[model samples]
Target chain A: MPHATGKITARELIDLQSHLMLESTLVGQFNHFARESTDPQFGQLCQKLAHSRTDCLQRLAQHTNITPIQ
Target chain B: MYQDQVTDKNLCLAVINQLKWSATCLTGKILECEDEQLRQDYMQLLNRTFAEQKEAFDLAHQRGWYQPMMADQQMIGQVQSDTQKLMMEQQQSMSPMHQMAQYQGIQAPQGLNNYQQSFTNPNLQNQSIYVGGGQPYYSR
Candidate 1:
């Protein structure tokens, strides 16, 4: 069944997935950078961002009520 | 176009799957790092990420969006048998040093079952990773 919460249409869910794809990739890149960086400060900041991606991912998942599938 | 074809459930499931893979990949990378301090930081982050995912899963479940499937007795047995076969094959084909080099600490997370819903529909499986629904643009 296609669910619509008020004005939130199915299109938005697709968009959310697209955004998440970018975000997850970006986080992965950031983590890679954090791992490779020699400077402690830069690495710490990148690591922090990689963590923050989690909260963003969570919000997106909540908004869409994503059906969990591995 | 694709939007019309996409049901709410399909859309939700796609997003959920992507997020699951993302988290797992991040965990794998964290496992690969040798620095203890960095690994600890990532471990903390993974903890937060898992917590948030749980909340989302609960909400999705409540709304009837997320449905987890239990592995049946036969399926479990099949998986065990398959594992044993693979182990034997690995033993026959590879040396211990090669195997150790290849194996990453990338086992599934505790909440792996959360994403293991029995999605048996083939039409659902063939859906592309991206949206826009594989429309024939030239037709227009």
Candidate 2:
């Protein structure tokens, strides 16, 4: 059943949490790949991909309503 | 000889695969989700993933790192017909019991079933493992 209020269901929460983790890992990997790239254009492409992943991570994190623990 | 290191093409291919999987998963979740806002959010994410996947794929293709053969129309039509024939055969082969099971949603137990069992079983309660760290908000 769908949650009526602002709260999300457990399934949604789990999915969001997993997505956040996956996106975070991807962002890190892309950033590293960008840094290590020999080709300038490929480096730019990696950076762009990293930025996209960061945006996704932020969006997923926002929906989960959880502050990242330091 | 150069030392071993991950190539740009390999990284691009990995990213493309990840984005493709993300898009596929989001599509399935969007279809299953009944919540309007959640479905909208999933759709937006899926769109972004599709775009990112295309960008990565195009880059790889341009670099001649990921070239796929183009199938002719005849082969495509043959495959489509074959798939349709297979689907029809499968549908026709379904027994009454199979249909009844499907209607009642009786299916084989999945990993989630065992996971749920762990929570209910007293002996297994303490043994239940948690991944991704402890988060209070998500449990709410």
Candidate 3:
């Protein structure tokens, strides 16, 4: 019989959090760079990167039940 | 049961690390691109990769197989802190120049501000003036 234990491992939680944060930071940096960029191409690239990061954040959130830091 | 759990955890860690490295590569490419369009394209690709990585992370988490591969959190924290400090230093180095330019603009715009404000106002159409004493013209 499978026991319904609400407890989860601390290491797992930390690892999940760390990866999510790293992805979020990367996306934020891309967005910031995009906004600062004068070149249209670079701005577009930054936007794309920011979008990717946001997607990653969403997926991670879905998996871990972690709400994004708005 | 313990062995199976450990194996699953290791596998999840491996997948996560792979995704992390891929993301790092994308980040490097973004930093390297000089052309804005190229950078934008690469950033888009990076985003797609990040989405994939997130999916993988979520999959592992859902299965309850994820585990921290790093033994020392302090080391990672130190590196992150150092990176933040460097970024702050760079921003601070550039801020004074920006502040000076802003100050100059503000000082020079003492009269221009009022002129601009008047021109922008919709209700101030009756007070329009040209070089010559033209009639109060309301431009569309």
Docking model 3 quality class: incorrect
Q: Write the per-residue lDDT of candidate 2 for residues A1-70, one digit (tens) a residue.
A: 1234666666777776777777888899889989987778888988998998888777666565543334
Record all residue pairs in model 2 with backbone atoms less than 3 Å apart, i.e. clashing: none
Instruction: Give the residue spans of candidate 2 off by over 4 A.
Output: A1-4, A66-70, B1-5, B72-140
TM-score of each: 0.34, 0.61, 0.31
Report the C-alpha lDDT of model 3 over B31-124, residue by residue, as the tens digit: 7545444345446656777775676567567766674476588988999999999999999999998887666554544464456556666664
User: What is the lDDT, from 0 to 100, of the residue A63 in candidate 1?
Assistant: 46
TM-score of chain B of each: 0.42, 0.50, 0.41
- TM-score: model 3 vs. ground truth: 0.31
| Prediction 2 global C-alpha lDDT | 0.73
Q: What CAPRI class is candidate 2?
A: incorrect
Share of native interface contacts present in candidate 3: 0.00
DockQ of each: 0.02, 0.16, 0.02
lDDT of 1: 0.53
Each prediction's whole-model lDDT (CA): 0.53, 0.73, 0.59
Model 1 docking category: incorrect
- Please give the fraction of native interface contacts (Cα pairs under 8 Å between A and B) kept by each candidate: 0.00, 0.19, 0.00
